[model samples]
Target: MSTESIRPLIGISCGDLNGIGLELIIKTVSNNKLLELCTPIIFASNKAINFYRKSIPDSNFNFQQIKDFTRINPKQVNVFNCWEEEVAITPGQLTPEGGKYAILSLTAAVEALKAGQIQGLVTAPIHKKNTQGDSFPFTGHTPYLKEAFAAKEVVMMMVASNMRVALLTEHVPVQEIGPHITKAAIVSKLKLIEASLKQDFGIDRPKIAVLGLNPHAGDEGLIGAEEENIIKPAIKEYKQQNNAIVQGPFSADAFFARGYHERFDAVLAMYHDQGLIPFKSLSHGEGVNFTAGLSAIRTSPDHGTAFDIAGKNKGDESSFISAIFTCIDIIRQRTAYRENRANPMKKLTNRLLANAVDEKIEE
Candidate 1:
C-alpha cells in the first residue's frame, strides 16, 4: 500500500473563529510535508477557511471541502464543514458566534473520533468564557474531553522536547487550590501520570518529580504542613505500594531555576501556573498541551487565543504544528505498546523455540 493509504486520519477542531486557530491550521498544513505524515481533516466550514485564506499573504494553502468522511483525501488537507448556515467571521473579536461555532466544530470532531472515523485530534485554542453555555459547561478541553470520552480521570500534560509537566489541579482558584491539594489527589494524579508515561510515551519506567504547593515546598512545616503532612505522605505511600521511582515535594522555585527538571522523565506540579509558567518559559513556543490517560488521543497548542495578533498573520504556528506531530507520535507509540504487550507468553515461547533450534545446530 502507498504511504498515504497507511497514514492516520488526524482531526482538527477550528478553535474560536475570531482567533488565530484557522490561520495556524492553514499555515501548518500548507507545508505539504505534514501531509506525508498524516491526513488532516479540519472540522470547520469552507466559508471560514476562505475568509482566513484572504488574510494570509501568499500562503499557497489549499484544501478539499467535504460534507462527510466518505470522501477523505489521504494526500491532501480536507475540510469537513460542521455547519451549512452563514456565520459572521470577526477576527480578533470575542463574539457569541465564535463560541457557538467552536462548540459545533469540537463536538463534530469528537464524534468522528468516537466513531473511529479519525485516529487522533489536534484542537486549536478556544475562548473559555464565550464557549460556556448550557450545552457545554466545562473550563477547558481537558475536562470537556474527560466527559466526552467517559474517561475516569485525565491528566493535563504539557509536552516538549526538553521536559514534560503534568498538573495536580487545573483551572482552580488560589484559595480553592489549597483545599484541593490532598494526599488522595496527589496519589491519584501520580497513578495517571505513571500509566500515561508508559502507555502513551512508551517509557518503561518513568522518574517523576513532584513540586510543592508553598513558596519553599512548605520549608519542612515552617511555610506549610502540606509537605510534611499531605505531600510527603502521598509520595511515600506511592513509592512503597507501587515500588515506583517517584520523588519530591520539591521547592517549585528552585526546582526549575536550578535545572533540576532535566534529571527526571516528567514533573507533576501542584497547580496550573506552578507548572505552566516554567514550562512555557522553557519550551519557547514548542510546547504541546497533551491530554494524557484518555483512551482517545487529544492535543492542543499550549497558547490561548491571541486576539491582538488574530488575522494579522503574526500568530506563530510552531506550537500548533507541534501539537499535530505530537498527536501522531502518541498514536504510533500506543499502537507499538499494545503490540508489544499482547500475548507475552506466545512471544516468549517463540523466542525459546528459536534459541533451542540454534543450540541444536551448534551441537
Candidate 2:
C-alpha cells in the first residue's frame, strides 16, 4: 500500500486559545508535505483556527471541518470541532474561556485516542495556571495523561536531534525536590527511560547517564549524600538487575559543559530544571516533550505558551512541528519493535523465500 493510505491519524489538542497554540498549529500544518506522513485531526472549532489564520500575513492555510470521525479526510487537514458555540479568543490574555475550551479540546481528542480513532496525539501548549480547575487539576499534560490513561507512572522526556533527556521529577518545587528524589524514584525512571529508548527510539541497547541532585555530584559525599546514599545505590541496583549499561550521578554542570551527555543514548535528570536547562539550551528551540511509558503515544513542543508574543505571530513552530514528527516516529518504532520481537526470524525467512523463488525461476 502507499504510505498515505497507511499513514497514522494524529490527534492534536488546541491548547490555551489565548496563547500561541493555534498560530503554531496553523504554521506547522501549512506545509502540505506533513499530510503525506500522517493524517492530522486537530481538536478545535473552525472559528478558532480561522481567527489565527487571519493573523498570519499572506497565508493560505486551509482545513476541513468535521464534528465526528465518520467524515475524516485522510488527504486533508481535519478539524474535529469540539465546540460549536462561539467563544471569545483574546490572544496574549489569560481568561477562563481559554482554559475551558482548551480542556474541551483536550478531552475530546483524548477520548478519540482511547477509542483507537487516532494512533497518536500532539498537544499544543497550554497555560498551566489557567487550565487548572475543579474539572482538571493536573500540573501539565504528562500528569494529566498519566491519570487519564491510568498509567502507573510516566517519564517526561525531552527529545531533540542531538540528545534525549528524561526527568525523574517534573514540575516540582526546588525546595520540595529533595524529598521526591529517592532510590525508588530513580530506579523507576531509569526503567521507564530504558524501555522507551529501546521500544520508542529503536535502540537495541540504550546507555543512560544520570545527573546528580546536588552540586558537584555531592563532591563524593562532601556536598550531599544523595549521590552515595540514594543515587549511586539506585544505579548499582539497576545495573545488577538488568545488566544494563547505566552510569552516572554526574555533576550537572560538568556533565553538559564537557559534553559527557554525548556518550550516552539518554540522560536521566533528578528534577525538571536539572535536565531541561541544558536540554533547551542545546536544542536551539527544536525540542519535543514526549511522555514515555504510556500505552498511547503523546508528544508536545518543549516550549510553553508564549503569552508575550501570542497575538504578534512571533511564535516559532519548529518545536511544535518536531513534536508531530516525533509522535509519528515513535508510533512507527513501537510497531517495528513489537513485530520484530514477535517473529525474530521474519526477515531471514523472507530472504530465504526470495532465494527459493529465484531458484525456481532459474529452473
Candidate 3:
C-alpha cells in the first residue's frame, strides 16, 4: 500500500487515571494536525476523557467512541470504550479503581495488537504497584508484554534525540541488582541491543558502551569483581563473536560527565537507576520508552504518572507527544525494512528491465 494510504493505527492505553495519564493523552491529541500522520485509537472511556476535560477545560481534544476496530475514524481521535460501568474519577488520588481501569485499557489495547487490529502501541504510564494483580503479576509493561507475545526477550530501552540507554536489570531493588549482573545476562542484553539497533533503528552496525555494576567500575577489583569477572568478559566474548562493536565496563559517573555517551549508538547500564537517572536528566521531559525486540512496536513516555499534579492541568505532554511520533516513525521504518528484505533483487531487476527496453528500442 502507498505510504499515505497506510496510516498505521496506534493503540494508546490510558494509564493510571489518578495520575497524569488521561491529561497527557488529551493534550497530545488536542492538536488536529497529528491525525494526518497516523490514526490514534485510545483504549479509554468517554467518562475518563470527560473527567480530564474538566481539569483542562481549554483543550480542543475530542474522541470518537468506537465499539471495535471497524468503527475507527482515521481523521479523528478514536476511543475504544473498555468498560461502561461508571468508575469513580478522582484525579491525583491513587485508588484500586485507578489501577483496575488502567489494566482494563492496557489489556484491551494488547488484545487489539495481537489480533492485528492495530499496527503499533503507545501506552501511557501505569503505577507499577497498584496495577499489579492476579492477572498482571509482573512489575511493569516489559515483562507483561514479554509473556503476552511469548517473546524470547524484550529490552527496556530509553530513547532521546541525543542519547539511547538500555537497562540490564529492570525494576529490581538496589540490593538485588548485583546478582542479576552475571556474564550470561550481560551477553544476552548486549546481543539483544545490537539486533534491536539494526532492525528497529536502521543502524547497520551498533556500538554499545557497557557500564559496570560497582563503584568506579570496580576500580580494577578494588570495589567489586563484577567488572573483571562478569561484565568485561561478556563484552569481550560478544565482541569476539563479531556481532557488533561492544565496549565498556566504564564507571557510570564519568561516562556521562565527559560526554562519552555520544561516542556510541547505545549505552547498557547494569540497573534501572544507573541508566534512567542520566537519561531523564538529558531528555528534559521528551524521552520515549521503547520496548525493543517484541514482534510489534511499543513505546511509552519515559516519565511515570505524576499523581501530585494530576488534576491541576499542569502535566507536560512533550514526552507523550514524542512517544506517539516515535511509534509512527518506527512502524514506517519496519515497513521499509520488510520491503527491502522481501525483495533484495528489486534494484537489479529494474536495471535488467531497463536494459531490455533499450535493446528492444534499438532492434
Considering only N, C-alpha and C atoms within 3 Å, which residue pairs clash in candidate 1? none
**lDDT agreement with native, every candidate:** 0.90, 0.90, 0.87
Q: Write the residue-wise lDDT of candidate 2 on 257-285 in tens digits.
A: 99988889999999899899999999999
lDDT (tens digit, per residue) of candidate 3 on 220-284: 99998989999889999989986579888999999999989999999999999999999999888
Pick by lDDT: 1 or 3, better one:
1
Model 1 lDDT at residue 235: 98
Please, what is the TM-score per model?
Answer: 0.94, 0.95, 0.93
Worst 10 residues of 1 by lDDT: 353-362
For model 3, what is the C-alpha lDDT against the true structure?
A: 0.87
In TM-score terms, candidate 2 sits at: 0.95
lDDT, residue 163, model 2: 95
Worst 10 residues of 2 by lDDT: 353-362
Which candidate wins on TM-score? 2
Q: Which residue ranges in model 2 land beyond 4 Å of their true spot?
A: 346-363
Cα deviation of 296, candidate 2, in Å: 0.4
